[model samples]
Target: MPDSLLVVDDEPAIRHAIVRAFAELTVIEADTAEAGLAAVRERYPDLVLVDNRLPDGEGIELIARIRAIDPDLPVVLLTGHGSTDLAVDALKHGAVDYIEKPFKIERLRTTVSHLLDKQKLGRQVARLSGKASGRSHLVAQAPAMKRVLGLIRRVAAVPSTTVLIQGESGSGKELVAKAIHERSARAEQPFIAINCAALSEHLLEAELFGYEKGAFTGADSKGKAGLFEAANGGTMFLDEVGEMPLHLQTKLLRVLQERRFRRVGGLTDIEVDVRVVAATNRDLRAEVVAGRFRQDLYFRLRVVPVPVPPLRERPEDILAIADHLLKRLAPELGRPGLAFSDAARQAMVAYAWPGNVRELANAVERAVIGAEGDAIRPDDLVLDEILLEQRPAPAQVSAAVQAPIAASSAPASAPALPPGTLLIPPGERHLARIEAMVIKAALADAGGQKSKAADLLGINRTTLYNKLKDIGLEQAESAAG
Candidate 1:
């Protein structure tokens, strides 16, 4: 839907001009503060433009009332007698921008467009953070994840406690942070997240603690509020925080210690009440020992340490998470009612997910897009293919494939190599023995065709030849040829 705008002005000409200017939007107009507040509640416009002089009251007062109704709704105050004091008061009461009378149409349009775009983006961020859909409701059927959830509950009860989440990449560290924020007393406030490793040191610094206007070359002329300032009275999630530069780490330490920070090139400290949740895949203690991280900051952030276990450690969650992800993804991708076959489920549980939840999400998404039938098969998941692509050791391959092979309906005493099939006997655990058995089975299944045997083994002919040489079958194959 196109964005909606609400204009509260006593003058009919001003309202008409705004309506004409924003013809594309569903413009709502009111002649008095009472009508404007009523329109705001009923129309639910994305932005509000109010004139200072209204029939019943001043628009500056309306700004606060409007904020009380919707704190995120952007308001622009319009006035003929514009003064520094009026502008300050409007801003203090929650007006996003102030405009003097006889403002250029283009300038008004640009300002309104910018504010609407910013508000829309903020809503999208909120949705992605799981605010819209009970994002705090995480899947914690596994005891490990349940413990992490318990930690989140305990820390969330304390509004200002700093939390440091340590985990491997893709283990849902940010999700845990969001859970804490959503369950806390500040759930209604903003939750801002930034990746410390994703930006350069200077840019990261400027982003976390905003810079003053013209603080440095290429700075925003109007200056900008950084994530720290934006997340006041809420939560600030610092992801990959171990990668933060050492110099900036000192400033961050100060913020944690004093709850105050100075904008870049600014003299005065700006005090803020923000709960910080920092996450890292790397071990910050190791980084500190190596002089890459601040020792003081490390200790401060570690006050409420929450370690997120890797997906492999919580084996029971594999199928559960896959099912959860499938339910969420199917309808989104226009492929609903898709499910994993029993074999697929066994394969998912057996394979080790080194990339953790992120990889599983990707795998499920790929399956949802590519599955041709109602149920996803093991081939669709391609668990064995992933292992083969990794070029794992023979023993590693055996461990990964053993369970799925056992789950197959093949007879226990079946011939080792039925045509186009290979089977491993029970109680076979030796790596070299299994390697030899698999190769010989492949050769037999291929009718002693070495090239076809290599294809059956999911390896190139050269690799197969080397394996044959290792098992002392090269001479026999050459003689047979």
Candidate 2:
């Protein structure tokens, strides 16, 4: 759908002109700030062409409200020569761009398009960052992840569908739930999280479907609302849905099937409009097949399951995550952001992370606390044991970052190549190895057709032929034949 725009102008002629110029958009006409605010609150627009002067108030006053409603919404101001100062004032209030009166219509249209695209991109960034409005969430950067982010953006526009987030422990599924909630129509409403694994059957049910007065010992004397009720107009993030007891799952499934629900000890059915975003670390399909989890409930909770990839899949992001955590944990640790030494950063990138982001966060925090100077060295990190475990059998730590394995360790008779079947020369020194692998794969895929392989590799046939010669794959192929 074309993004909606609210054209707020006191002059009928100006409003009509804007409406005609931006005919591609769904324009909502408002002559005053009150009208604009009402229109925005009623249906938040993608862009607002707010007049500098409104009938009841200055357009700038609406900025806080507009942002309060949806901070991502882009607001532009319309100004005359006399109101240029007022335009600046509006700009200070969060208006992205201004259109001066007697301005070129083309310029206004171009500005509008550029600003809209920018606003969309910013929204996507915020969405992918998995942050709630004004609150930072987890940052994940895996190819599998960017795909999930795209899904979040697509799914956010349609908030009614349930979303199931699946991942290994500490993979940040909860963060994704919060991102979806923050982007949905019910963003301003409360976000309630209940860990199904953390509570027993009776307690979990009472906590979710709220107990009435005297429903149980130590219950609120008057009454209390459950997370489902508390999150009436917003979201209920059920973490560890795999752990929810079967009885409770039936109740939750009923709630999902029907919007009306009953509180504990309350006969009256309380209705709520809640978006359910359930998450779990366990293999739910296995649970379903094993009869531990209800297949029907599983299907309900997993309307749109977003499985987060383990940290090991995205080795490239380790440094980025470390830097982000270091910056964030600095104030808490009473130390300003010190830099990571080459060794420290390399250790992080080299280690095969098993526990994902939570482990990484703890590792960074521990390193920060142990670190004395402004730099974190390899020793500062708590990764030696983890690294040793992931390395091949008969593993040993090599001090040389640049030296070949033969120079660092191993008997002269042993192969210089690491114990691993595939020898990946250090990325810098092993360019030839990588080239060989690339050429080998391409040639295999093309059945040794050099020209087609080169095209697939995005290089000229001559370059492919030369690379093939350099790798000595031609001699091997001929000998094998």
Candidate 3:
């Protein structure tokens, strides 16, 4: 299908010229801002060309409305010689580009083509990143995971099918969703996700369907667009779908059936073209039998049910996944080039990961921070010691941050502060000064190794670098300097 363009201008001659110039596209024209907005609602165009001065309102004002409707829809401001200021203002309001009136038609055509091409390239890059990141996060060398991968590849080819992913917590259902979306034909579009169990029914309804301005107290005056509108031409991942409110489920079912829905406080029914990918830990069939889930919605979502195996079910993957996590966590935690000892490896494989991959990731992160040496010992695993050794209490962290200079166990050579002087204060300027001091102190304490300093501060090296820049402290600065 050819891409559609909307030209909103008061001048009939200008509109005629624009329509004639873009004969290759399906051109839609409107004479006023009101009519332009109506045309936008009627035909969702890929690009819009609005005159800076419209009969109903300035084109700049319409850009915000256009953005509220579809943030990514490209808009170009059409201006005359003296309207350059208005054109610039329109760009600030979300117009992608501006074209001067009495301009060369070829230049305008080239500009439009270039902007569209750039937008397409951006979407393509986002799609590729989604694919690469999803694949990397999915660590599946075992047969069970390989089977899961195969299923994802197969279903991804069918973009319109609603995929229901069943898995325990931390089994990476979101990763599977991304894989399917990235591989699908609609990869270049958005991938919007929501957790049904995370919000109250009222809030969930508002979030999913949006609301009109001043629909309720504290609502943004400009209103908002919902995930359905945001995810148009892409995929929507509804995590914990079984936990969705019954009334909202009915509304969701309507959208799935008719491909349209009305916002919470709006009368207009908005159309959307999006793929649905739902996931839940609960058995939807059982929920339906118990009368806790809607059968129609359940059946609609389960058209291609994909199950993700828990980490314990694939014991062969225990060591491999641990090693993979360590390779990532070790450097970030400042324990660069650290390795798991033979005993640690053995202990990892022996233990059943009840909390699944998430538990494993936390275990590795903790071990990276608390380990006494370069090699992670069996004792460092701490899986069996949760009951024996209490986790670090809140007081310990508080004391570390707030201890008085005289009370601190720092070396005698360490600079002393005034009695009862708070190292960090609530004020932004004071907090910044104290933060800089702390970074300087950590770098000094770590002998100026950025990674080691980051580890000492319980932050990643990248974060440390950003802080250093913020404090005007060069990375090369040492304790002596």
Best by TM-score: 2
Ranking by TM-score: 2, 1, 3
Reference-based TM-score of each model: 0.56, 0.59, 0.53
Model 2 has a clash total of: 0
lDDT of 1 by residue, 1-481 (tens): 3568999999999999999999899899899998887676545577899999988999999998877656778899999999999999999999989999999999999998888667656655664576643233367767788898788878988989999999999999988898787667676588889999899999999999999999999999999888999999899999999999989999999999999999998899999999999999996754653457787899899899999998867766777789878865665566767999888876676666778898888888888888999999877875545442332222222243345444333222323565554455676545567668767877888888989988877778999888889988998768988
Candidate 3: clashing pairs of residues = none
Clash totals, every prediction: 0, 0, 0
Per-residue lDDT, model 1, residue 12, is: 95
lDDT, candidate 2, 1-481, per-residue tens: 3567888889999988988998888889988887776676544476888776777887677775576556767887777754657767777888887777777889989988898767656654664577543333455554566787778877778978999999998877887887787666776677888898998898898989998899888998988888898888888999998999888888898899998788888899888899999998886764663357888898888788787887766654567678877865654456665778887876676666677888888889888889989999878887866453453312333234223222222222333654323334454334345556656776777887888888777778887777667778767777999
Assess candidate 1 and give its lDDT.
Answer: 0.81
Query: Cα lDDT of all candidates, in order?
Result: 0.81, 0.74, 0.77
Q: How many pairs in model 1 have backbone atoms within 3 A of each other, for residues 3 or more apart or on separate chains, i.e. clashes? A: 0
Q: List candidate 1 stretches off by more than 4 Å.
A: 1-137, 384-481
Error of 1 at 220 (Å): 1.0
In model 2, pairs of residues that clash are none
